[model samples]
Target: MRKTTFLIPILVIAAVIGLSSMFIVDERERALVLQFGRVVAVKEEPGLAFKIPLIQEVVRYDDRILSIDVQPLEVTPLDDRRLVVDAFSRYRITDVEQFRQAVGVGGIRTAEDRLDSILRAETREVLGSVSSKDILSSDRAALMLRIRNAAIAQARALGVEVIDVRLKATDLPTQNLEATFDRMRAEREREATDERARGNEAAQRVRAQADRTVVELVSDAKREAEIIRGEADAERNMIFAEAYGADPEFFEFYRSLTAYGRAIQGGNSSMVLSPDSDFFNYLKSPNGAGQ
Candidate 1:
């Protein structure tokens, strides 16, 4: 019974040690065997891995692509326009051994922190070199590629491969938003003012042309009327001269009658003249002679 008890305890201890010496690494993970916090072996392939019991430890890191959301930061573009930018990145640990050495016990958390810094710095550098219009435009695709490339170069030291970098949202700062809107409104107003001014100028030109046309038309009408009036007066004088040449007595009688009609038009008219006066010649004789 005593020997059986001793064997049971020994078997239990051996089983515990055996379990501690072996670890199963999934296909999505890479394992690092560390001795006293020093990486002694790198297990990249998925399967069973071995480590010294209680003397060495294993650290597993994801072999799959990882993602990080970088904090939003402000950047000033070439035009001195400031914008707030939110970004993210896809990355992977290409070298587990190097990653282990670079990050130590902090593991994926530390690597991500470093990667975030790289993305931010590269983002600022790439975005700062261009105008805000480019960042906000479709050309952003090219700019994102540039950022990824720059990040890939810098992230090498962290044993990470930057697969892609992208800007989520690029916008004006909250305080600057109102100011930008005001500027836009002002620009629109200025354009409207300019258009209105041009319209008014065109209207003035049209009005002046119309006024000139009216003045020219009125002057022409007045000149035509004066010409017609002078022609009519000449025709009447010629008719009178013909009548006088055709019959002297009849023309004198007509002239005397026209004068009498003018001198006694209304019933209240009064006139006093000599009885044998030439004015009474038409009344005394039908032939305008004092017969």
Candidate 2:
């Protein structure tokens, strides 16, 4: 019983010591062993690792890429068009030793802040050289590439590898957009109104011309009709004159009878009678002595 009691305590102490001196590195993590707060060794592979029991400590860093989203910032294009830009960065700790020596475990936030400042400055510098039309058009990719190259160089000095730099969103502020749209709409409406006015003017001119043509046509038709009627009347007069010349005695007798009928068919009115009156001669006409 005494031997068993001693052996159990010894085993417990050994187990505690073993646990304190050893650690496991996961495939997804890299560790740095620190002694008295100084980096003594770095373990980059996954496996069991040994260290001093109480004096040494381990600091672990993620081996996978980390994503940090920057706050939205205001930027301007070459045309002085203001916009809000939201961006993010993807990075990984490539050299754990250098990363630890440069920035401790709690320095990721500071690194992101620094990177954000650098990215914002460089983004403005790069995009400021381009026009707003180009920024909104097919040249956005080329601008992004240039920005990434500058950002990568900046991030490398901090012992981090920049996987990518991306602009998530670019937008004009609401108030500015509203003003711009209003101006654009007004201009378009002005153009449309001008076009409609020109069309109306053309239509009025064409209608006036058509009215004048109609008047001329009516006058031409009236002239033609009057000429035809005059021609027919003249031809009838010539035929009548030729017939009257051939039969003078018959025409005289016929003219006397026509005059008697015209004088007698009348309402009675008082008239002074003369024996030599022409009307009376017509009433007595059919006698050959009447001239």
Candidate 3:
């Protein structure tokens, strides 16, 4: 009975020791073997890994991609406009050995601080050299690329591979929004006023042109009427002169008759003349013989 009891205890101790000496590392995890708190081996591949029980320890880390949420902060752009940026980063551990040396027992928390600082500094450097409009435009992608590249170069010492840098949201600071809106409104109003003034000036020009056309038409009409009247007078004088040349006595008599009619043209008219007046010659003799 004593031998059986001692054998059972030995078997149980062996089982415990064997279980502690070996560890199964999942594909999603990386194991770092340490002896006396000093790194001895880094197991990046998956499967069973062996370690001396009670003397060696295995620290596991996530090998999968990780994400860090950056706190929102303000950045001033080249245009002197300030914006609040909410961004995040995706990263993964590429060099576990170096990670251990840099972080020591501090682990992922210590590495995060350094990585975030690099990302933020690079973002600020890129954003500061560009105008606010550029940051808001499609060129933002290029700026983000610059930030990621710069961050990747700086994060090499941290044993991390920065996969991408992304901005979730960007906005004008609350304090500046009202001023920007007011300026925009003022600019729109100025443009509207200018458009109206230009329209009015154009209308005035059109009206002046129309008035000048009307004046030219009236002046031309008056001039044409005067020309017609002068031509008619000349033709009438020529006709009368031709008639007088064909028959002088008859023309003289006719002219005397026309003078007499004109002298009495008014509805109420009277004239007193000598009874021996030459005007009476036509009345005294039809042949106009008594001159």
Candidate 4:
């Protein structure tokens, strides 16, 4: 019975030691075996792993890509324009052994903090070399690529690989926003003023041309009317000369009658003359002789 009791205790202790020594590493995880706070072995593949019982412990880290959001920071471009930039990064622990050695017991959190600093410094350096227009434009993809490349060099020391760096938002600072809007408004107003001035100049030119055309048309019509009046007067004088040559006495009597009609037109004219005056010849005789 005593031997049976001793065997039971031995088996129980062995089982406990076995359970504590064995560990599992999932496909999504990488583990480090630490002895007295120092890493003794690294298990990168997913499977069963073993370590000394009561002397070592297992520390696991995510094997998948991780993300870190950098706090928004201000960057000044070469143009001296300041912008607020929010960014994020993707990274993966490439060397588990190196990662543990660099960050010690702090693990992923410590690595992330160090990575954030590298990213911030690289972002400022790359973005500051360009103009604000480039940072805010579609070319920002190229700028982001530069940041990732620069960060990759520094992140290797922390045993992490920088996959990508991207700007989430780029904006003018609150104080600069109003100033930028005012400048834009002023530019638009200047363009409008130029357009209006051009329109007014064109209108003035058209109006002057119209006035000149009107004067030319009126002067042409006046010259044509004067020519027609002079030709009509010449024709009337020619007709009178031919009539006088055809009949002397009749022409003389017609002249006298025309004179009398003019002197007494409207039957309200008054005149005093001798009875035997030559002006009465046509009234006294049809032949215009005072017989």
User: Who wins the lDDT comparison?
Assistant: 4
Q: Which tens-of-lDDT digit does each residue in 1-291 have in candidate 4?
A: 999989999999999999999999999989999999898999998999999998999999999999999878899999999999999999999999899989998988899889988889999999999999999898789999999999998999989999999999999999999999999999999999999999999999999999999999999999888898888888887888899889977888788888987898785678999999998867777544644
Residues 248-275, model 3: lDDT tens digits? 9899989989988888786778889999
Best by TM-score: 1
Clashes per model (N, Cα, C within 3 A):
0, 0, 0, 0
Q: Give me candidate 1's TM-score against the actual structure.
A: 0.87
Mark the regions of model 4 whose C-alpha exceeds 4 Å error after superposition. 244-291
Worst 10 residues of 3 by lDDT: 282-291
- Ordered from best to worst TM-score, the candidate numbers read 1, 4, 2, 3
Tell me the whole-model lDDT of each prediction, alpha carbons only.
0.91, 0.83, 0.90, 0.92
- Model 3 TM-score (2 dp): 0.75
Any residue pairs clashing in model 1, and if so which? none
Q: Global lDDT for candidate 2?
A: 0.83
Model 1 misses residue 227 by how many Å? Answer: 4.1
